[model samples]
Target: MGLRRLAAGLLGAVTATVALAGCTADGRESACDSAGGIVECSPDQRSAAPKITGELLPGGTYDVANQRGQVVVVNFWGSWCAPCRAEADDLENTYQATRASGVTFLGINVQDSRDKAIAFEEGRVSYPSIFDPGSRLALAMDIPPNTIPATVVLDREGRIATVIRAAVKQEGLQPIVERIAAESPEPAGQR
Candidate 1:
């Protein structure tokens, strides 16, 4: 099927009660990003993944700071976003399936509280996520704040390999992941 048809097909099959403020192309940025408010990233998103830290959920103790030498996938979402809810399963599946390949998936729940975010995960998603309670991180990144369901793929060397600004499928994810795994680090003792 064509891209349009595939998108439509998938959209129709997915069910979500949460209200999506706006939608992006690949579910990485806020679904509602107006081309006008969206600012481009330095070195672009395909360059080195910027060094940053995010407060973890559950207890909010550990902060996921670095992405060096690992393929990190960051998904920006919120409990209020329908599309984000729709992609929850796919994201979890990707996380579980890609571990051996040295890929790590992290979620950034933009503009959401801990309770709502946790409910979303336990009820539907199985991956780990960070709660961006005050929109601080979103503002710092210069992305349109509250744009649920965006994703950023960082390469093994910590470079930004790609950004999926809308809902994405498994096929759309493999190529970049493959390339990242090719350069992934082996055990410390291994050559």
Candidate 2:
């Protein structure tokens, strides 16, 4: 689909009550739902995964465009997001087990100060994460405004294959990543 149409569709979707603003017991923003959870894009509905490039938490830069031909897992999270913390270990474990299969994970940290975010991932998580102090990367992914702890799995062609809203579990995510990683590249012009 054209960018205009995509934008329009996303706009329409956004109006459907994806997130509500509230405070958790800890006084952190509580974001829930993804309008309706994973927006599945048909083959015809596929769009190139948004280009992502930024300074990683520990060091170096990460560019999503460079991950073409590999299945890429993009997870949006924040230090203050309780669900993010709940799933962090599961995500890291999945990453470790799947790396040999050519699956890569990129965490996008949003709405947290650099120090706190880095501290959150320093020892418990092993994957590199983009420190998005602002929501630029989230906006690029067309994430519903204010939703954190969302995950997007990109197919080998770099098109978005699946999106998971809310916290992710290993049981739910492993099969999806394996399936994408195992797919043979589409023939020329077939993608």
Q: Candidate 2 lDDT, tens digit per residue, 36-90?
A: 5655554455556667899998778988888777789988999999999999998
Summed backbone clashes in each candidate are 24, 0
The prediction achieving the highest lDDT against the true structure is: 2
Q: Supply the global lDDT for candidate 1.
A: 0.61
* TM-score quality measure for candidate 1: 0.64
Alpha carbon lDDT at 75, candidate 1: 81
For model 1, the superposed segments whose C-alpha errors exceed 4 Å read 1-45, 142-146, 184-191
Task: Report how far off residue 3 is in candidate 1 (Å).
Answer: 45
Deviation in Å, model 2, residue 76 alpha carbon: 0.6
lDDT of 2 at 51: 76
Q: Could you tell me the C-alpha RMSD of candidate 2 in Å?
A: 10.1
Per-residue lDDT tens digits of candidate 1, residues 1-191? 59999998777656221223323334434322234323223223333344446667776533445546667877888888888877877777777778777788888877788888888778666657776777565544423333556776666656445556676455556564666667644455642
